[model samples]
Target: MLAIECAGLTKHFGDLTAVDHVSFEVEKGERFGLLGPNGAGKTTTIRMLTTVIPPDEGTAKVLGFDVRRKPDKVREKIGVVLQGLALEFFSTVYDTLDIYGRIYKMNAENRKKRIEYLLSEFELEDKRNERIDCLSGGLQRRVQVATAFMQPPEILFLDEPTIGLDPQSRRKIWQFIEEFSKGGYTVILSTHYMDEADYLCSRIGIIDYGKISALDTPEGLKSTLGGGDIITFGVEGNVDLLRSTISKLDYVEEIMAGDELAARVENADEVLFKLSEEVVKAGAKIKNISVRKPSLEDTFIKLTGRRIE
Candidate 1:
């Protein structure tokens, strides 16, 4: 069963359209990613899916419940961790989750079991009694995520879940998300971090100006940019001289030379051979050379004029 579905989902704020005819489907247990830069309609889309707001046009369904008509049913099956920290600074982590459990109408015994399991899963058990204001940014993020899972909803929506976290905390969150999927929970996450999406999502939808520019698996998206490889090398001598030499090469379409020279080449090995010999003849020192496949950023740039900062 599909956990989430949107058919031409759109949202407008007065005259401006925040989300424009967006459509996609996330399968059950899939870790789906909504990728876009700020003001690209990612948050707006999340709000609509979570039934926090209604769409001006189009439709969305969460866990088979219509977000517009059956909002309560949708809300009952989904967990949301938004970009902002929704915690009360004066409250302890335990109390914050306890409150949500009560709101969900979880019985005392079940709530206790759920809270204990979540605290341990998120590694917040030791700091359960600590006030939100007393925790570091990473710890606070963990609490926010743990609170979302306290209800054991079938679907979870996490917007920038690891934004302020350190490397260790970020990895811990990733592990928890993976484990959540393993336990049959479908995760829909929004993030500007390309590496994070690449690591966690089974499929990613790249959005911009409220529209989906691309949708595919990470490897599939990269392949859409074509199969060519990128070759980058460093030159110790004059950059201008290197630029003039490399730009004229037939296989090199784009040559950007600075402290380093990067080029999009049709044949990586051939270009490297030619460049190496030419640099030697020009009396320029060769620092390093590397060849890599196109990245998710590369695919984003190819479709949109801007990068996903």
Candidate 2:
């Protein structure tokens, strides 16, 4: 069964439509990502699906339960880690988790084991006795994420799970998320980090201005930009001649300029050799040559006409 499903799901605030007829599905054990810039209606969609808020139109179902008709059942089967820290500052890490476990109705015997496992798994064993207020931002985030697993719900909803974290902390969290997904749990992650989504999500849906702009696997989306590599270089002489001569190659797609001449090509090595020869023929020498494969970031810009940030 689909772990989560929505059809023409929409939400509005007075005159503004926060989520405009968005629809998608997440299968069991799938790592689904929602990609968008700020105010792209990603978080609003998550909130509705998690049943924190009701949609103004259409329908949503989580884990076989209709969100509009059975919000409690949906909530019981899902876990959420929202944007900010969601812990009580006064409680110690262990106590915070213990409290959450109790709230999930976990019995004492199971709750104790779950708490111990979470502390160790998240690398929070060292901070178990530390008050939530005393922990670093990364540590606090770990605790918050661990709390979500108190009940180990079937579906997990994460909104920007790694925001404002250091590289190490972010990777650690990614590892935890990966391990969690391997246990056959569904994860719906919303984030602005393109690399994170590209690495973690099996399928991605990009939203813009409250609508889905694109939806597919990372490679599938990148292929829409021609499935080629981007070649960039600087020419010391006669750039116009170089552009005119090199643009004729069959593998070359198009050229753009910012700090240097960039050519989108079907193959980097093939075009690199041809481009170098063309530069010499045009009486220009190449410098600072670089090759970049198409990425989700490039696709996002191609679709949204702007960067995710």
The number of the candidate with the highest TM-score is 2
Give the alpha carbon lDDT tens digit for every residue of 235-259 in model 1.
Answer: 6887777778877877777764224
How does each model score on lDDT?
Answer: 0.87, 0.89
TM-score, cand. 1: 0.88
Best by lDDT: 2
Candidate 1 at residue 140, lDDT?
94
Error of 2 at 34 (Å): 0.3
How far off is residue 67 in model 1, in Å? 1.1
Candidate 2 collision pairs: none
Candidates' TM-scores? Answer: 0.88, 0.89
Candidate 2's residue-wise lDDT over 1-309, tens digit each?
A: 899889999999999999999989889999999999989999999999999999999899998899999999998899999988888999999999999999898899999999999998888998999999999998999888889888877999999999999898899889989989999999999999999999999999999999998999998998888877888776798676677777887778876433356678878876688777766777877666878987898788778877766
Model 2 scores a C-alpha lDDT of 0.89
Candidate 2: lDDT of 65? 94
